[model samples]
Target: MNETVLYEKAGAVARVTMNRPRVHNAQSRVLLEGLDEAFAEAMADHDVRAVVLFGAGPHWSSGHDIGTPEELADRDARPYRPGADGHHQRSWDWNVENTMRWRDLPKPTLAAVHGMCIYGGWMIASAMDLIVAADNAQFLPFLFQYQSTPWDIGARRAKDIMWEQGLLTAEDAHRLGFVSQVCTPADLDEVAMAKAHRIAALNPLLAQMIKRQVNDAQDAMGFRTAIAAGHSAYMIANLGHAFFDAENPFGSRKKMPGIDEARERAERTK
Candidate 1:
C-alpha cells in the first residue's frame, strides 16, 4: 500500500483504490508503480479469491496526466538509462502491466466505476470481468481531448467503444455489453461487491482455468498484432506535424454528427 494507491484484504476479497482524488484519480508514474505493487500483493495473497477496483473519490480515473509544460520539457531533456537488469521498461509499463494482470487475473475481478472513466482509466476497467457503473458515471475515452495518444490496449478498446460502435450512453454501454450492470452512485459498490461475492463462491481452480482459456482464445485472434498497430498509428498521428498545426486539425475529427450545429444544418433533409 502506498499514498497513491490503497490495498487491503478482507476475507476472500482484495480491494484496490486509486487514491488521488484531487486529480480525479489520474495516474502518473508513481501511481502506476503503486498499482503494480497492489496487484502483485493481491495475486500472491492466498486468502484473496476476488479483486475489486475503485477510486477514493468522485472519479473512477481520468487516465494518465500529461504533466506541466516544464515537466514535459524536463522529461525530453533527460537521458535514457538502462537498468542493472540491462533493460529499462519505460514509465508507462506500470499502467500497461497492471491492466494486463487484471485482464488475466486467475481470480475474478470487478470494476466499480463512478464519475469519469476516461482514456487509460477506461482501459483498466475494460480489463476487468465485470463493470458496475453509476447512473452518472461517464465512460469518456477522451480521445478528443489529448494531443498525444494513449497506450496500446487503451487505444484499441477506445476505438471499439467510441468509434466502431456508437455507445455514447451508459444505457448504451449496458445494451452493448461493455458494462455488466448499472446502478446509482450510492448503490454501485453494493452491486459490485455482491457480484464479487458470487464470483468468489465459485471454485477458484475452475475460475483460474476459465480465465487462462479466455486469454488463450484472445491470443489466437491476432490480439497482439491489432494492439501494436493501433498504438503505433495513434502515436504517429499525434506526434506528426498535424498535431501541432495552427488550426488544431484533430478537433474536427469527431464524427458525432448530431453533436455539432453546423453538421446538423448540413444534413437538413437535403
Candidate 2:
C-alpha cells in the first residue's frame, strides 16, 4: 500500500486516513493506489463491521494535482517520449475505481470531514454511506468546468453539492440530506467514533446484506448511466491548447468557470 494512506483497525472498526498534509491531502496517483489496497483489505476483513475515513492534518483533500491547464499545455507543446503505461488514463481510471470501491463497500462507512473538503474531497465524502462534518469544515465542489465528461458518479454528486439547492452549510447538509450529522471541530472525533461503534454493534450479517441490497438495486437501475450523463452534461471542459500546458497557466488563486456556466455550455453544444 502507498504511504499516503494509513490503515488500522480497532475491534470491528477500521480507520483509513489520508496522510498528505503537504498537499492539503491532495489525491495523487500514489494515494489512489493506497486507498484501493486499503479498501480491499477492509472488504476482506470479516472482523471489521464499519470503516471511518478521514484525513490527516488540517484539511481533508483538495483534488487532483494537475497544477494548472497551462502546465498541461506546456507538456503537450513539447515533444516527449511516451511512457510504457498511459499515466493520464491510469490516473482517471484509478480514481474512479478506488472511489467506487469505497462507495460500494458492503459494510457501512463514514467520512469524518473537517477543514477544507474541496473538489475530490467532497466527492469522497459523497461516496460514503454517511458523512460526519465538523462545523468549521467547508465542502467545496468547484471542478465542473475543467474536464469534458458526463454522467460520472462524482459529477452527479458534485452537481447536488454545487447546485441542486446550493453549497451546503453543515446545517444545510443535514437539512438537504447529504450530511448524516454535524458536530463542532472539538467534538468531531468523538461523534464519528460513536457513530462507527454503533454501526459496528449491528449484526454484521444483516448489515452487509442490507448494504449490498441497496448497492445492487442502484446498479440494477443503471446508476453508472445516470452518473455518466451527469458527468457529460456538466463537465464540458474541452481538451484544447489553453487547457493543456506544462505549467499552471492560471495562477493559484485563479477562478475559472463554475458549475452552472459549464453545464449550460455543455448542454448548448450538445
Candidate 3:
C-alpha cells in the first residue's frame, strides 16, 4: 500500500515485506500503517489462504524508529492531542490493539525473522501464528519497552531472558518453542514460503478453526489478559521515564550507557 511495505500474492500465499532496509525496517508510524493495510488487503482476498511477513534487508527490524525526529513529529501531528500522556496512550493503543488484531487474523500467518528482532519487532513476531527464523536471527525483548516475553516464551524462560538481557539464537528460540523452525539466511525465504504454502494446502476453513482453537486455549490460560496487564505496566513505566528520567523524558529510560552496557551489567550480575 505504501513504499514502506510491499505486498504480493503467489497462489494462496500472500507475502508482506517491510521495505526499510537502511533503517533495519524500523517501525515508523508510516511503516506500521502500511503493514496494516497490506495485511488487510491479504485478509480480504479470498484466494489468500496464508500470509508471510518478513523484512527486506539484512535484519528483520531493529525496533521502533525512536531516533527519527521527522517521522516522530509526523506521527505526533496526527489527530492525537500533543503531550506526554497523549503520546503514551497512543503508542499503547497502537501496539496492543494492532498486534492483537494481527494475532487473530482468520488466515494463518508466519513471520520470517533474521538478524535483529528486538523490542517492538519481538512483539510483531510473537503475534504471528508461526515463526520461521534464520539461523542468524536473534530474539531480544530489548526490555526497554513493553515486556511480552513471559506470554510468548513462558514464565521461567522469560525471567532468565530478561535477567541476562539475553540474545536468543534461533536454536535457543526453537528449543523454547518460540520459533517453529530455523533455517540458514540463504534458505529463510524458501523455507518460510514452503511452510506457508503447505499450510495453505490444508482446508482453509479447518485451518482457521484450528488456529482459533489453539488461541482460545492460550486465552483460557490468561494469555490475553496478561498482555493487557503488561500494557498497563508499560504505561506506568513510561510515566516513570517521563518524570524521573528527565534527560530523555518520553523516551526509553534504558537509553543511558546503551544496550551493550546494560548487557554487561546483566552478565556481571549473573
Candidate 4:
C-alpha cells in the first residue's frame, strides 16, 4: 500500500483500502499494483485470518480508469504478459486472472461496499468470499473483465440487473444473494469488521475447507467457464463499435461517437 492503496492490520483482520478518493477510487495501474501487493501480503501472513476490502471516497469506484492522463502513461509503461498478446494484456492480468486468484484465496475475504460500485468495482467486490454493503450503495455493471455476475447472482437476476445498463440497490442485491448483509453507511465499517472478527475466530483450516468446498461446487457448475466466456463476449463488444454497416475493424467504445456522422447517429439512438 503506497499512494493508491492503504493496508492496515487489526488483530487478525487485514483491511485493504483503495485510496484514490479524488477520482472515486478509479483503478489506475499504480493502484492495481499496490492492491496486488497488499493482497499478497495478507495472503502470506499467518496471523491474518480474514481480509476486508474498502474504498476511501464518496463511491467505492466509478469503474476502470478510462484514459486519465496519469493512467494512460502507466498503461504504456506496464509490461505485458510475455507469451500472450499485448493488446489489453495487462487488463486481462489484473482484472481477470488476479480477480480469480483472489476468489480462490485460502482465507476468508470480504468486501465492505459503500457508494457506487461500478463495472470495475464489481471485478474486485464480486471476487470476495462475502460482501457487506451499505444500504445506499449502488451495484452497477457494464460487463467489464471476468464478469461473474451471472454466477454471483444467478442467471435470471444477472440479466435483470445487467441486460440494459441497469443497477440494483444494496437491499435488492442482498435479497438476490449477492450481498451478505446491508447496513447503514455509518455502521458499514463496524459491521464488516464484526463479521471479519467472527470469521477470524473460526479455525483456519475449517475456514478454508468451507471456502474451497463451496467454490469447488461453484466451479463444478462451470463458474470459471462462464466467467471466461463473459469476458470474451465483453471484448467482442468493446471492439465491435461501428456506425451503420460493419466498417471499423479495430474500433472500440473508446472511439464511439467517432465521426460527426457517428455522433449524430448516437444522439438519435438516445
lDDT of each: 0.64, 0.67, 0.82, 0.81
Report the number of the highest-lDDT candidate. 3
The positional error of residue 243 in candidate 3, measured at the CA in angstroms, is 9.3
TM-score of each: 0.75, 0.74, 0.90, 0.87
lDDT of 2 by residue, 44-162 (tens): 99888899998998877766555444335644674234541333334336555466667788889999988766666766777788889998776556433222112222456655545
Task: Give per-residue CA lDDT, model 1, range 28-115, as digits (tens).
Answer: 6667678778878888988888999989887787676556343246445753453312112342244444565567777788889887
Q: Give stretches of model 1 more than 4 Å off.
A: 68-95, 142-167, 242-270
lDDT tens string, model 3, 51-120? 9999988889877776566466876577465557676667766787888888999999999998878778
Clashes of each: 0, 25, 0, 0
| lDDT, model 4 | 0.81
Q: Which segments of model 3 are wrong by more than 4 Å?
A: 144-146, 242-244, 251-270
For candidate 2, the clash count comes to 25
Candidate 4's clash total is 0
Model 4, residue 149: what's the lDDT?
Answer: 83
Error of 1 at 257 (Å): 19
Top TM-score hit: 3
Question: What is the overall TM-score of model 3 with all chains considered together?
Answer: 0.90
Candidate RMSDs in order: 7.2, 7.2, 2.7, 5.0
